[model samples]
Structures are given as C-alpha cells and as structure tokens.
Target: MSGAPIWIGAAHCVSALGEGPRFHLQRMRDGGTALRTVPGLTAKPMFAGLIPDELLPAGPRRIQRLLDRCLLELLDDLKPRPHERWLLVVATTKGDIAAMEQGDAAASALPLLGEHARQRCGFGAQPLVVSLACASGTAAFILACSAIEQDRYDHAIVIGADALSRFVLEGFASLYALDAVPCRPFDAHRAGTTLGEACAAVAISRDRDRIPEVIGRWVAGSIAHDANHISGPSRTGEGLLRAVQNALRIADLRASDIAAVNAHGTGTAYNDAMESIAFERCGLSDAPLSGYKGWFGHTLGAAGLLETIVAVQALREGTVLRTLGLSEPGVPGRVNAISADAAVPGRMLLKTSSGFGGCNAAVIIEAES
Candidate 1:
C-alpha cells in the first residue's frame, strides 16, 4: 500500500496556560507557568491546571458545548474541502466521566460523543472514540493517518479531551501517585504527577506540498504494550525502546539524527527512570529532552496530542520550554531539562508516551520543508 502524507492543517488547545494556539505559544515563550494548588482534595497539596469550575459547563450538555466551542475554533482555522470525506476521532480515557460523577444524566454512553461531533462539526462520517489511556491522543493521530492512507478519508479531525473527575482523582490518590503540588518531572525531589484537564484538536489531511506543508512528517509510529503490569511501566523500558526503534527504523533514521526528545516524564520515580533508560537504549541519552506535564499537568488522554502540538511549535519556532518542575536531575545520565534560551534547529522531534494497561506509543515529527 502507498503511504500518504498527513498534513496538520491547524491545531487548537485549551490548557492551564490558556486557550487557543496564540495564548499557549505566548506562555511558552514567556516561560510562564500555571501550576497551582487546588483546595479540599486532601491534606497533601495537588497542583493542576484545573479549568476553573465556572469555565467547565455544569452538565453533560454543557461539556459537549465546551467541546463544540473548541471544534468551532479548529474549523475556523482550517476550512477543509466540502466534498472530501471527513473523519472525526475523539480520544479520551474518561469521556464525560466528570459529569457522571456529578450525577448528570447524559454522560454515560460513548455514542453521545459522536452525536456531539456530528452536531458541532457537521462531520457526517462516523465518529470513532479511542480510549487507550494516556496514549489515546497520539494513537488517535496515528489512526487518522492510517485511515487517510487507506483512502478511507481525505481529512480527519483528531480531538483529545478529559475533565478532572472524582473517579480519576481518587484512583490516582489510591496509587499515591498524585502530587500534592506541581509535579517535578525528572527532578531529584520529584514526588508524583498532577492531573490536569484540557482539550486539543488537530486537523490532518493527505494533501502534501500544500500551503502549510506538514512541518512535521509522521514517517512512522507504533503503539505497544508491556503486558506486564497495569499501573507501572516495564522495568527494562523494553516496550518503550521497541517503539522508538521501530519508529526510527521505519523513518530510515538513526538515533544520532534525533535532535531532541519530548518525554512522557510524569514526575514519578519509575516512569522517569524507565524513560531515561529507553532513551539511552535508543542512543538518545545526550539529546536535549523536555516534558510539558509539569506546566500543563498530565492531561491524561490529551497529553500526547497537546504535547505533540507543542513539539510542532518547537520545530517551527526552534525553541522548547524547560520542564517546569524539573531540576537536579533525578535520572542519572539523562540530560538536564531545557529551562531557558535554548535553540535547536534542523532536528526531528521524537515524542513518546506511556499510559495505564502498559500502553505506550512513540511518534517522530520533522520540521516543515
């Protein structure tokens, strides 16, 4: 089968920093951080980009309304061809689960999401929901590319969103993985991850060499599982390294060609160490690497896509923000986090993510030609 070029036409995101691309890019450039404390959770402080309660709509209908607003922004940015087949792919580990916890009536069924997609975006194609834990966002992007390659769709809308829910909060609390304060990824004093809520949408198409020639090429990507544990990562970083190797090999590139890495550094002990090892195995230990979760909190399902958006921006802008809470190097031999005024040009952006159920994924994006 012939491969197709997936062009990221436009991207829109809402996070702790702000809403939309302009807001987020400004925050990144200014080195501004939005990590703060939330009250009434537990004695320990929890730092997250908790969307203001007021900003979050009251019920399921309201949540869908919020999603529609973001979708409209994406559509406004890129008005795709009317005759082209458009596929809608929504990624979230807990879709409307926050509403369900509040006893909202319409948050239970998955199909309700498709209805929202259809109503809001006018995407007549069937909606697909991917709930593959943290990798959901990146996985959704890969799936959309596959669909286009197979001639199933000319354009695809990939959106990832999740709201902080009691279920999620309590579950992470049980694992004692919820940091009371902003997470310190790869920091010697790192504690745990802080959960954040966010929504991000990207428009991808098969048309290549177009106006916005895909700045980043999704040459190859893979999703693999450790099948070893549900919560913790594989001790050897086997799964992660395998995915990286596969991506690099498929792209006909070597680890030496990678300029930097956007890691899935959740600020947890095990994850940081494993990721470090994976990078080392892939011969990327010396590469400049960073993580955004400390700034945006772990947006769960949205983390991958939102982070990828930032990676694309890094490619276009030639700079990456430092890991917000990272300092003192928790993982040995792992390069220090980029904190300020570092410029990397002519390099490929390698992004990696791991989630519950041992799900892991990695993708490589190059600068726009």
Candidate 2:
C-alpha cells in the first residue's frame, strides 16, 4: 500500500436506496432493505431492488441517463482539462438491453454505451468496455489501476450499470436462480438473488495534482477463473481462493492484516457456500465479513462497484456493515460472519466478487491514514 497513491479522485452512485455514495452508506446503516416486491414480467410478484421511477427520467434510454448522472458529477469534481488523458471505461452485463428488448433493430453494438460515455464526458482517450458477467464492475476498476500504473491513461473513469429488463429477469428466472423474496447473502435460510438496478463510478489517477480529493489507493487486485461451470461457481471455491490469496500477496499483506471482508454474497446456495470455503482457505476465518446484496439486491454488473464505493466510506469511518439477512452463520466454511455491524480495527478492506462463467475477482482497498 506504499508509493504515490492513485487518488480516488471522485465516486458517485444511484441505487434504489437513493443517490450519492455517502447517502447509500447512511441508508445501509439504518438497518433496512431497500428492495420491495414488484410484479415480475408476469403477474407474479417478486422482490427486486429497482431505482425509484421518479429518480429516472421519463425516457427509453434509462441506462444512459443513470450513467450520465454519475459521470457528470465525477468530471465536475475532477475538473480536468479538455485535453487531459482521461479514459472512459464502461462495465455492464446487458448494455442498453432495453433498446433491444423494445424492438430497436440497431442496438446490437455492445460497445456503443462506452463510446457514448466517452463523448458525453469529453474523455480524451478511447473508451474500453468490459462484460464479465457479474464480476464486470470490479474487473473494470482493476483494469483502471493497471492502465494508470502503465501510463496508458492519466486518469480512468470507470462506470458500471445494469437495469432490470424483461430479458434479464426472465433469463435468471428461467434458470431458477432468483428468489421469490429479497436476496439474503450468507444466510442459512437464504433462497436466491433478487435482481436490482444501479449505476456507480470511480475515478483513478497516479497524479495527485490532477485530483481534487484522494480516496485511498487501490492497493491490489486479482482475477481468477475456475472454468468449472458456465453459470455456476466452483463447488470447491477454487478460483475465489486463489483470487483472494493473490490479492493479499499483491497488497504485500497477510490475511490478518485485512480488517473486514466485503463479499459478493449473492444469497444463492452455491455462491455462499463457495465463498465461505474460499475465505477459510485464505486464512481469513476471523475477519468480520458481510454482503451488501441484501441491501441493494443483486445489481449484477453494478454490484461490485456499488459495494466498493460504500466500502471506501466504511473503511474511512472505521465501520463494518452487518449481513442484513444473516442471522445464523450457515456457510460451509469457518469464515467469520457478522450479524450486527461493528467497528473495524484496521484500514485495509478485502472486496471479493464471483460471477458466472467461473469468474472470480478480489480487490484490496486501503483507507488513507
């Protein structure tokens, strides 16, 4: 965690709970879920965490509106020169799928969203888009760090988002992966994930002079894939175990140094069990850990970025969030799971995410002293 810090620059978000990163933190602290029962694509009611209809404009391009709001605020905070080497990176699973679902014949170009972001934000560097199933958000942040470290760009604006669409809801529902009620991560009686929508962003740069404010450095990140199943995580937690260990090693810290763990905790049966095994193998058995899915539902690509943003605030304020729906520790591994929020003793936070196609990513965020 040493060396010239890659300034956090700025970060923002819009979720069901509300707008802004800090607002989401306080809402979570209030100890209630923002998700509610909504009619499914059909008449059947299902739990989902959706952005309030009022927060969104009356329009078809809702994804664009959500992302623009975040990027607009981020660029305003950084106040970069028009010619600055700023890159726009977009992370999403179903990029503007609404247009396609609405019968727009020309919406198949997936990278169109990122390019639009670059133009909207006036970025000087070409945009990069990533779609790694649910791990897309964290992977985008990790890529931003690598690009900055390699001098490919002076600053990186990584924004990730996905909205609930008929295609996505039916897809998960067909697979029987969605819960009838709100998703509960790591809870013994947890059923499955409830779909949600969110847009989140973070700015990263090596030059502190260009950043208005510093958010802690992104110390280390690692991504691994077990290739065990296309839509399922490795039953043995093989990929996640390696990802966490490698992330700790890259941060040059042992397992004990991590003050808390912000796990993906999608509330699915296999995913929860796999994360527990991975944490135990990483020797992070005693670290306080909880998942944010219960609060925000599974926002898919937006999940990791939204969670990471809130985690930065948590580490800075020395707070550890409780697993909202977790009453009994029921994962297979011996990892420590907290039911009630507590104070954190250290500054480093280990953030991990696992997604379909066996993708697993671990990122370490350190709070500035």
Candidate 3:
C-alpha cells in the first residue's frame, strides 16, 4: 500500500441508463428500472439494458463506437503534460465479438480493440487489454494504480466497454442467468441478472494539484481468485473476504471506517448471498449497502468502472444511492441494504466485485477534502 496517491481526475459513461455518471445516478435515485423487455441481439423478448442506437456513434463496428464515444467525452479538456507518459488500459469481456460472429475475424482479438483506442487517444504506449471476465474493470484500476505507483506512467486512462453480442447473451442464457424482468438484487423474489451494454472511462493521475477537483483517491485495491468454479462463486465467500481484508490493510482503514459498501449484487441467488457473507465476514454487514444492477443491468466488463464512477459521484454529493429493485431482504447476513437514498456522514467508501472464474476485487475510495 506504499504507493503514490492516485487521484480520479475525470470520468464518463455511456450506457442504457444514458451517458455520464450523474445522469445514471439520478436515474437510480428516481427508482425504476432501465431494463426493458425487448428483442435481444441474440434472442426475442429478453430483458436487457440496451444502449439506444442513436446514442451509438455511426460506425461499422458497434463496440468501437461505444469505446470512442466514452473516451472522447472522458478525455475532453483532460490535457496531459508534454513530458508525462500515459498508459491506455481497456477492460472488456467481449470486444467487437459480435462483429467477429459476423465474419470479421480481426474483431475477436483484443489487440485490435486496444490498437484502435491507442490511436484515438494519441497515447504512445500500446494499450493493455484486460479481459478478466467480470472483474476486468476493477482489475484495470488495480493495474493503472500499480503502474503509476511504480513510475511506469504519469497518467492512466482506464476504459471498460462491452456491447451486447449474441455470443455473450447466448452464453449467459444457456446458464439460465438471465432474469425475465428487471433484476431485483437481494430481494426475496430475485430471479437473475439482466445483461446490459455500456462504456465507462476514468482518468487516474498522480498530479492532483493540476486536476484540482479530485473527486476521490484510490486508497487501496486488492484482487484474489478462489479457483473454486468456472462460473459459480464459493459458498463461503472466502476469496472476497480476503480481498476486502487486503484492501483495508493496504489503505490502513478498519471496516468500521467504511461509510458505505457497494456490493456486486447481480441479483443471482448465489451472487447476492455470497456478497452478504463476504461483507459480514469483513465486519461490514451493518454498513449502508446497495446493488445497482437494476438501474443499468450488469454491464459485464464495464460494471466495475461504471459503478465506481457513480460511487464517486455519491461521495462528492455526500449521499448513498438506493439499491434499485430491492424490496425485501433474502440473504442470511444482516446487511443494511439501502432501500432509499440518504445522506451519509463519512467520506470513506468501499466498492467490491466478484466475478466468474472466482475472481474478486475490492477498492477503497475517499472523497477529497
């Protein structure tokens, strides 16, 4: 944890919940569901949080359009110094995979996506493509911070984008993980997750003095894998517990110092329950908690960065966002799941994510004074 303090300079998101973190946060606060029962890119009548076609930039490749729009907006007015070395990190599960399915073989390769981003962003270094299942976005943050701390780069642009594809939709559908309606995380009647598409970006830099309005600083980040199952999480929540503990240790903050917990409540029976167990084990059971999948669906690789940006907004506004679609508690642990938006007293917040392949990540964000 003895690293340079990485500050969040700017962030933006384009998703089914609309563009930008502020707009999406307000939609969450308004309380409904961005999920719609529409014909999916794969099948008919599947509930999904699909970005509107008009919002997508005109292009032959949909995934590239998604990435370009978010990057353009995120880097707007973010002028890096002439001597500063920059790193471009792209986190995604499937990048232009749908195009690959449509006979574009190059689209299947992550490097192609990375090359496209590097050229567009005018960064000299080759982009690091992180395809670590659902934990890609959170893992990207860990990589960016580590690189900056080690003096590998002066600034890092982390972008996570995943456009819906038949390959991904069919895979999740085959697992019976798609909900019939908008997802309800931690609710007694929760069914499953709703797949969503989004592109989210955040700029992290050590030059906090240059970017004065530092929304939050990356205090600590830790990632661990249980190797328990390919898709299923550990029933004991051991991996996530370890991640939270490592993050807290690195940040030198106790569980009691956390003002809020943003759990990866994907509305699945096991995922939500496992998260509850992890939080309880970390002594964060009573912390104000929320799951935002109902608001924008699970944006696959973009979920972590997208949600983190929203959490940054919450820290700036001094509020805890409500978990959309949650009604009654179903988990065995006594988590204080936020049902309504409320003002929070402290500035420290914890964000956690658990993904396929038993991957788990936790990061602490503290509002800048």
Candidate 4:
C-alpha cells in the first residue's frame, strides 16, 4: 500500500438544495441559495436551510433515510467490489438528535447510530463514528484515507449526516450564534451563521484503474486544536493555521500550489476573522478564497465532506466557487475572498474546517492525475 495511489472513488450529497451532486453543483453554478425563513420549527421564524418536506420524509428515521440514500448510492457505484475488509466511517455532531429531545438518550447515543448504519446498510463492516463538532466530517475523511493508505482496509466510505433538531437549534440560539438572515461569509455586515441539514458520502479506494469515478487524490490531511475555547475559535487562528501548514508539508507542496481555499466560513465574526488571519499567515492572502455556508448554510457535521466534493469539482473546472451573499470583504485581514465565481486555473484545492472545542482540520485535494 505504500506505493498504492488513493482515490476518491465516488461522492454524493443530500441537503436543502436537493439530492445527488448535480442539483447542488448546478445550484452553486447559478449562484442560487437554499436558505429561507424556516418556520414552525422554532418559536420565531428562523433563517435556515431545511430539506423540503417533499424531498425528505418527516420522522425520527430521517437520519437513517439519509444514510440509506447516500450510502446506497456510493455502494452501488462500488459494485463487484468486496467490502468485508472495507471501512465505514460515520461523521456527525449529534446522531439521532431528535431522539434525545424525545427523552430517548440511549437511541441518541452516537454508537447506536453507527450500529444502525451498519445494520441498515447491511454492510459486513462495523462502523466508526467521528463526532468532532463541525469538523467531524473532515476528521472522518482524513482517517478513512489514512487507513486505506496504510493497507488497513481495501477501501473506505465516509458518511457525514446531521439532521436539524430543536435541541441543536436552541443550543446555538443560546449562544446567539444564529443569524437573522441567510449567512454572508467574510462579509463585514455578517452577523452569525444559519444552520442547515445535510448528508454527504465519499468512497476512497486504492484501485485506480477500475475506478473512473475517482474525482481526485487525497493528497494530505491534518487535525489540530488551539485549546482556546469550547465554542469560539482561536483569535489568532493558531490551530487552523497549523493544520493547513501540516497538510501542505505532508503533500510536499507550497502555499502557492493551492488553486483555491475551500474554507469553513460559518459566517460568524470570529471564525471568519480567524480564517482570514490564518490564510494571510500561510501566504495565501492572494488566493481565491470561497465559502459554501451561504449556498447550503452551515451543515454542521456534513459540511466538510459536502464542501470537499464541491471543491474537487471546482478544482477540475479550474474555477473558484463564489462566496455567496458576500458583498464586502471584511474579516480584519487583506484576503482575496471571492465575491463572484472566478477562474483559478490550477489543479489543487485547500479545504479547511474548524469546529467546537477548539478543533481544526485541513485536507488538500489535487485533480486526478
């Protein structure tokens, strides 16, 4: 496996925008947003993104359904492939959060969700659940890639899903982290983040010749923590900065190699400012920087994987996705934040995520060679 090449064999997503990668990608190309004033879920009408009732069934099993749709698709793409030695990594901030609100703590336990995925998907593999707040998806992805590269598994599947729930919504509200309108990442007038629900899946395999769906190579990944605060990111962006540097080092690439920076821009004041500082420190101040929160809102645990898929597509197209809803560059640093879609014309992408408990992660994806 040391000489083997790892590839993202397949990937897909389900969210407020729609199902499959086409809808999401088309919506992004058109600069359309799925965010709206979602009502009836909270006391007041809150600005957030919710899977339309027609698109996603309403019930306690929505999470399971998401796993079903996302997992089954990737698994289908992996036909004729053995899975007895494959790895399944589920990433979520809160699994079956609705169960907790309904006074079923045991059902809400993360491992139970993992077991459900294994049983529901009928895979021969047990599940490993990664729950590192908003960074869970990326962390899980990093692990899966590393495992396959180390010959620990024949292949790896990374699934990230987090449904919207009152418990989670109110928790963010308590911290005054919900924005009054759709989020505007890196914008001066940005207030806070708007939450969204989504499930995203990616498959990684060493068999490149047989897998044309392989979008790109997972060049490198790293995780770091600043120990700054539980919810707030480091004011100095220390953790995120370090993670990016480590990833670049591992890939043996310089900052100039990154075509675009697919950032975890949650639209929060502190997060955006911190990322601005981090990119500047990496000498990426002139890079085309973009965020996806405005297009899909903050999809929590699903964010990293979902955004990574988009970044891969962006890298192949040699263009940077727009930072939707961003009118003015603000963040207290001189960063080249994209206000509109622009040509980057490069083969590499730098995707970074930051989450609660001072956790941060980075992954560098390169166009399939």
Least accurate stretch of 10 residues (summed lDDT) in model 4?
75-84
| Number of colliding residue pairs in each model | 4, 0, 0, 0
Q: Which residue pairs clash within candidate 1?
A: 45-180, 46-180, 215-368, 322-338
Using alpha carbons, what is the TM-score of model 3? 0.96
lDDT of 3 by residue, 1-369 (tens): 346688986788988989877788777777578788767466567888899988877887889999988887766657655577889999998888887798978658888998999888888778999988888999898889888888888788999999888788788889988788888999888988898999999888888875535779888889988778888999889899999999999888999999998888899988998888888989997789998888889998999999888987886788989888888888876789987887888888888888999999998988665
Measured over all alpha carbons after superposition, the RMSD of each candidate to the real structure, in angstroms, is 2.5, 1.8, 1.5, 1.6
Better of 1 and 4 by lDDT: 4
RMSD of 2: 1.8
Lowest-lDDT window of 10 residues in candidate 3? 73-82
lDDT of each: 0.77, 0.85, 0.86, 0.86
lDDT of 2 by residue, 1-369 (tens): 225567774778998889987798889998589998877654466788889878764445888888877877887887768777787789999889888877884784668888878887876577889899899999988988878777777788889999877788888888888887788788888888888899999888887667665667778899999878998889889999989989888778999999999999999999999999989989999999989888878888888899998887877888888888898778899988888888987988889988989999999988755
Give lDDT: candidate 3, residue 226. Answer: 76
The digit string of per-residue lDDT tens for model 1 on 38-102 reads 66654455676776555544453534755765787777766655687888899888777756766
For residue 95, what is the lDDT in candidate 3? 85
State which candidate, 2 or 3, has the greater lDDT.
Answer: 3
Candidate 1: deviation at residue 29, Å?
2.7
Q: What does candidate 4's lDDT look like per residue over 221-296, in tens digits?
A: 9999988898889988999999999999988999999888999999999999999999999889988999999987
Sort the predicted structures by lDDT, highest score first: 4, 3, 2, 1
